[model samples]
Target: MMDFPLKPVDHRVLLPVMMILNGVSLATAINLVVSLDPEDKITSKRGSALTLLGFIYFMSLSEILNMTALYTGLGHRYRNKFRLNSGDVLDITNKFVSAVQAAFSCVTGAIVCLWSCTRDFMRTSHYMSEAYAWFGAAYFFYDIWSMYIVHLKMYSKRRPFKNGSTLLSSGDGASVKKPDTSFLAYCKHEPVILMHHLFIGGFGFLVIVYLRGDLGDCTFGFVYLMELSTPFVSARGILSRLKLKSSRLYLINGLLMLATFFVCRVISLPYVCYLYSKVIGSSYIDAVKSLPTGCKISISILLLPQLYWFYLMCSGALKMLLPSSAALSAGDAKRRS
Candidate 1:
């Protein structure tokens, strides 16, 4: 397990920061619900608003779990158990798992966003839209915060390794082993990997744009594309840096996330078309009615990917920062000769 640099003050500050952010999300959700027009009673807009509320609540809950795991040192246990050795198998398995997790997070976010947007489209209410926008913003902020913590933990772990004896041999009879890779190394090419996710998202957005006559459909498509692609892009960048060969367990996880993304996109097409019809001034309001089913299926498919990706990200970060105590044993010292 990796050692963390968290002081008492750090915990105190982080707790309040998380709380304030989550509280704002909750308040925004409530405001959206409360501000709904009385005349729009029991419409799709109400459903969408409610869905947004549920998602925000869940996101807050997830963040709390993450914080607890990080602060209480449970995160250390998880990392210790799962951290990959340098010679681990390179397989497609982890990639698949990551892909699945990415897909799941996207699906989950999409459903919540879609539900809110659908409700608004049905009645032209801005409450759902506002709530949806706020939810996305809140999520982005939380993700950034979490990523920072993960980075800090990684660096703290790396310090010991950096100060330890060399692992490799050089021509001068000195050790030449490079320090284990850092999490940043694993994620350095993230921007490049994110391009694929962006492309997919752009495709979704363009499809929605074509259906502009049905504002509801357009909204759903836009949110779905945004929600689904953002995490995948982010994860892709992270995965790219890890250099988990196609055969590694983590690679398989990533592939699963990717597969989920593909599946979710396929499932969403019909709904997209329906929304498009509505957008083009077609009286086919019922086109969007079938969207809930697809959305639900997508949500279910996305669950595994989300859990796995989170696990990998946490574990990988720790591995990059902290070398196992065993790596510095007398035997290892002798091996350097």
Candidate 2:
């Protein structure tokens, strides 16, 4: 969608104007959808048609945002300001887009979660959740394509080739890429992420449209709120790619990332279970034990990966904040000497 190559005589004048114009339209559309009367729009027979409109609305917005970023000097100006190579610029561009998408998803998730929680945590249904599911599903499709572009570009860039090295060298001594950078390669390298996206976009979409039956919007809302931590993840990627790991902002963001991931992605699931326990007037342990086998398996599947990721995050944070073990041992040896 970002194919605009014609920069106006002075794009600085045009950029903000374009962004505001698009932003207003996007906001207006969201407000309209959010304000829909569930009885009139959702419970009615035309509910399906309205949601189709919602899906197209968001997909169009994604395209427009991409074009805005391309033509508004958003990505190009950043490249000029930072003096980063073109090879890394696309990654930065995608990160900017990813951050924006994550922000929107987080906001919509918050809206759904709040509205549903205030009613009833599990059984009560809300139009907001119903509406935003289309957008969330659209994003999963868009993001998968965006990420594949990143991987393709990264692997296509010149990589070093040495004797007994992973990379191969062209006959003229120029470096070449190792392994295929095809879609299959991307799928092979990222099975977990692929499954996660498919599970949410496919299975979650099933829940929203077919299986939910006006109940469990609260559960779906909680699922949407899982994106709460995603903006931090995107920011961390952008900062790391810019070689800003030692900066104060990076450290602060890392802290926030870990905290948000723990709260939004990890603890949020258990919190839902606790809420369920309270709803059923049962003890937490008993409530958990009372869950169906399928439910227990699903929760475990989600929670285990989160726990593993949290451990890795903590390890990375310690490695960044504290002295390395090698450095500590060297210091102790010097003192002894």
Best by lDDT: 2
Per-residue lDDT of candidate 2, residues 56-97 (tens digit): 544455455444445455755766666655446656666666
C-alpha displacement of 303 in model 2, angstroms? Answer: 2.6
Candidate 1 lDDT tens digits, 1-337: 1234467577667666766765775676567556555323334464455445545554555544444445546644643455622111111122332343345345535554456445655434333333334333333333333343444444433324456643455678886655445546634635433333333333332333332333443345333453353354445554554454333655555555455544444345555556556655564455444446745354344334444554565565455445575456656889988
Give the lDDT of residue 66 in candidate 2. Answer: 48
TM-score, every prediction: 0.41, 0.78
lDDT of each: 0.45, 0.69
- RMSD of candidate 1 to true structure, Å: 13.0
